[model samples]
Target chain A: MASLPPKHRLQSSAADSAATGQHEHHRPRGLMRWVLTTNHKEIGTLYLIFSLTMFLIGGVFALVVRAELFQPGLQLVQPEFFNQMTTMHGLIMVFGAVMPAFVGLANWMVPLQIGAPDMALPRLNNFSFWLLPIAFTLMLSTLFMPGGAPNFGWTFYAPLSTTYAPPSTTFFILSLHIAGISSILGAINIIATILNLRAPGMRMMDMTLFVWTWLITAFLLIAVMPVLAGVVTMMLMDINFGTSFFNAGGGGDPVLFQHLFWFFGHPEVYIMILPAFGIVSVIIPTFARKRLFGYASMVYATASIAILSFLVWAHHMFVVGLPLVAELFFMYSTMLIAVPTGVKVFNWITTLFRGSISFEPAMLFAIAFVVLFTIGGFSGLMLAISPADFQYHDTYFVVAHFHYVLVPGAVFSIMAAVYYWLPKWTGHYPHLRLSQWHFWLSVIGVNLTFFPMHFSGLAGMPRRIPDYSLQFADFNMVSSIGAFMFGLSQLLFVVIVIMCVRGGKTAPAKAWDGAEDLEWTVPSPAPLHTFEHPPQYRPVEH
Target chain B: MVNVVEDRRPQVRRTVIKTLVVLAGMCVFAFALVPLYDVFCQVTGLNGKTASSAQSLVHQEVDDERTVTMQFVTRGAAGLPWRLEVEERQIRVHPGQSAEVHFTFRNLGERSLVARAVPSVTPSPASLHLRKLVCFCFENQRLAAGESFTAPLVFQLTRDLPPEIKAVTLVYTLYPQENDTVTAAMPDDGKHIDAVATRRWADRSSGGET
Candidate 1:
């Protein structure tokens, strides 16, 4: 083994003479440090805490929506307000909740995983994190505008958005532009840090799945965020200017809006989940005590999924009356996506097969993700059948399919990643029993909430309706109850996380017996600066 | 030193490939701009001929107790029967001008129907101002029992309306409500009477001038 780098060597020598027990440095004092700091770990904490706050806020909006839909007679809010709740709920969850959660994880883990001193562009990292709160504040403030918030669906179709938009739509579009800027910048930072700052001997293939997946995800974000920016900019112009971009009377076709929206939208779905795939890829291997099965294939499969995302957007618009040939093409391309997705699923299951298994909270969530996300994938495949989608489009079936994917797929994975890495972040093991309660309640509440929606949709209930037909009454009641439970269960997660942050059983450097990674090799509760000199890498021989 | 040099080769190659891939991607996406721009044009209705006052309309006052008989004409893609109705049975109109008519509808059977209405106009387009005095399409409406109701549209023919142009049409589509909404024998290209035909009686009373 090589000696520590010169700077660390000096510090360790000084520590050896002076200290007998583990000592932690006082956190940098003052607000100015946070505002101007370029430290990756500090910025990472900011991203995580900000995202958690957004999650709670977005969760409240979801509760509002469920409360209104609880008995189907607009018990709590008007239909327009319900529309705003749904739109803002989706916007905040995707941008504020899931994406930033993953970015937070990246900031915490990337430097350690790659043996880098800090992110390649540390100032940019801080800027990215800070941009989130500003963007979301603008978005959330729109709720109180004169005509109320963006009552259009988060998808924000035309004519509905143009001829009938509220004054706040302009502000909503600008805020999204800001959020897009933040995402693209964060993605660029991740890409540069991963590509340029890895330790001397760490080969591209030698990096952990988390880093590899994030590297690809960063590229995806950079590629598509601008497209989202472009689309929203066009919406802004159409609203303010005399543009007939989506107005039929002005010689524009409304369906064209769907195509552009879904093009950015489809890749965006992957952007939200791909890093979760990275998180699970790391967790599953550690708990199973096996190198991830088919490592090369996993990378290739992820790349394939990203590539396939571009071709399959039209699958979202099966009912928009596309030409037959185009419909057939999109159907086959969408179905083909199932193959790479299957490869990912198969690899995860086989990694777990016949392995000495443990049910740590992180592992528990990962395993649940495997099952629940697959349920979502199957529903997605059912939707891929174009004719069937004609029936399912904008129905509760579609709603069930996405929430299953998003809540369990992205949200659970974020929870799992936090549990997996919390020891490193805090130098303490979280309260296991509280975490278990959080897990079980979330699993039950999430399934109970979304699973009933499939039946309601099959029975011909449309989505986005504040009130539903009486025929859908029973399932809606069940779903509403489930939604409340699900929302409440998430609060338990908040408690567990806060408790973990405050104090817990002190953890050793390698917190788990089987955990193997460069990150674990570092000190518990990693230093403000990490791997100031590149660490050497030796690949595990199978 | 030798191993370092050897490792550097593939790293450089990877970087080069990565660069090329990004460049190629940018190029391909740059090309995509044309189609996306076209799509943008289509979606925003930027490329098609627009009705001068297609979205909102304005109306002039009806002369009190002046029985101004008006005719309605319906036309669109053939095989789709169009319907229209007036919320009020009759309204007084100043000579050489028009007033709002409430047109209501239901698609009795299957195939999609595009409904167009030409109101009797003394003057049209630039000369006449057509105002949507009130409309329910702005909100959701459900028709009852093969039902119908009138969407109120008000307009005044400008003195400039070509005397030959005595009518204006308000067109919309009755896309067959999804199958879930219909509960009877689905018609295969069903033919139904056009509502504008009822205006024929009004036209006869108004001297069948057109």
Candidate 2:
């Protein structure tokens, strides 16, 4: 119906799926297929499902933490257990929920968007995806261990995490090692796929921002995940090997541990959010029916942000008694980051200006991400001031600032990506009424949970504590209620996803009006192998 | 299709190898942070690990015009059974002049115990210029049951101490050690784990900040 090459490719892909399905039917069925299958789509589905499950698990831990903080006294859990909840919540959310979800999205979309048949190394993809559950299992099992799970907070600052840590700290480190291996391997696979598999005519610049951002994100993952592995390994040595890497009495400084953790930590945050920038870039333009404004600038801005991420790691350590010169240097470098971040915000807004804007669920989430993420950005700038950081560091304000970025920024963007692509994945249009409800409830719940934290933090409530002074009572109660509301509202998201996947009105190949990517060129529920031959890329006339 | 897939395999292998190399390098770099952090601190004196020998304590003329109140504070960690107290609560000393302070420690516990006193000076900027000639914190102290001992600390604040600082506090927290060694909880947040060292400074002209 279209042109010769695409038509031929589609026919062959359909035949390919049918024949493969027949062969798959003859092979060991059920879980064996998932365990051994090299199909990108199936593996992507596994990753997405796994991340969703982890999301719920991490959410429960968060609720437990909020519940205990509901009152001044310890209400639901002991102090140590509360610490475990806070620690595990941070670990599971960052590693299990956010990182894997981004990787899952990359697994599904990177090859399709780039006109590749599958991931560059399909078997490696399966290995990476499977390693996650094992790592998390080992980590979660530590909760039941004799000494309990890691309770030193997720940042796991030294002296706290090293000498005085629980016995389960070794398990936590090993689990992180496993997880880091998965991330590094996953990053390698993504880099290979994006570099090697692009269609014949598609220029690097012409690729979707999602793919571009991922290419950058993959590099970041490769660069920093090993640093995480290395740092945790050093922590391991310090714990058991009689190494005084962070022991002051052994002539090692504790502040050195902060330096290493934040070096990995700062880049890790960008790894979660850069892909978010790419996703928002794609969705905002599509729903606005406008060519993304200043596409070149957007790409440069992302690169700048990545480059600047390394320079700002020391900013997190201002209160650790850095020299005055070092403090001033870190402060200026941190504030300079606001310049490139402003460039990105300006570009997104410019893309939305005077266009045929629509209010789909995806757009609503994207819009909210822009607004709320900026609020987080403003708070971050406020924290960058060295003197001010002394007041805000380790406080609820820090908690609120990160949540605003993560829950509303990174987590919200993932929801946006899912809603935007669900029709294509399921071959069924999403139930709009349900999705809208999910979006509104999520936006409301996110704000309610994180907003009051700013005030509490400002009023001098330190984080990672089981109980706060009575002064923080009212705000904690409101935050806990909001957290529960947010947790419950996500069930609606599950319902929406399940309902769409099961059956609904069929969606056409072009699910949305403004869709013009290579992915949309294929039929809905893209055949097992969508692009056996590279799809032709023709520039659209402006 | 078969040809294309086969041809790209080596390229994929190459990128994968390259990425693995980067990953390995980063891992090595991470472990490198240990010595790197040490060198950084040594160069900058940022971590407050002062090297008295490295500093050339030239005799800059004493500031006769201004006198700063030097205070000694002693705190016992929660688990510590030793009662530690400073001999002099406060003293007035001019910049560049050496001062000696005494602290008394008594083993209140029934058993003989090993205690280590870790010293910290604040405001921290002044700690950089405040050099110690001899300190009891440099060694471990063992006290028999009911035994009491007094240890002396001799230090001089260099003339480089900022004019704004009219006072300085030197705190020594006595921590009970195990197996003849102090625990690793010496730096940052000493209050939580074992003993604590908190030095408070209040300029006479300016009100107490804390």
Q: Native-contact fraction for each model?
A: 0.00, 0.60
**For each candidate, what is the lDDT?**
0.72, 0.82
Report residue A419 deviation for candidate 2 (angstroms): 1.0
Candidate 1 residues A34-68, lDDT tens each?
78767777788888888888999999998998888
**Per-residue lDDT tens digits of candidate 1, residues B131-197?**
3223332222334334344445454533433334334444443322222332221112221221232
Q: What DockQ would candidate 2 receive versus the native complex?
A: 0.39
Residue B177, candidate 1: Cα error in Å is 29
Stretches of model 2 off by over 4 angstroms after superposition? A1-27, A468-473, A540-542, B52-70, B92-97, B123-130, B158-169, B175-210
Off by over 4 Å in 1: A1-28, B1-210
Q: Estimate each model's TM-score.
A: 0.75, 0.89
| Residue A453 displacement (Å), model 1 | 0.7
- For residue A498, model 1's alpha carbon misses the true position, in angstroms, by 1.6
lDDT of 2 by residue, A1-542 (tens): 00011122234655565655565456556679779878778788888888999999999999999988888997789998989999999999999999999999898889889888889888899999999999999999999999899999999999899888999999999999999999888989999999988888888888888999999998888888878887788789989998777776555668778888898899899999999999999999999999888888888888988988988899999887677788899899999988988988998999899989999999999999999999999999999999999999999999999999999999999999998888778877778999999988888888989999999999999999988999999999999999999999999999989898887878787888987788888877666667776778786532
Shift in Å, residue B157, candidate 2: 3.8
CAPRI rating of model 2: acceptable
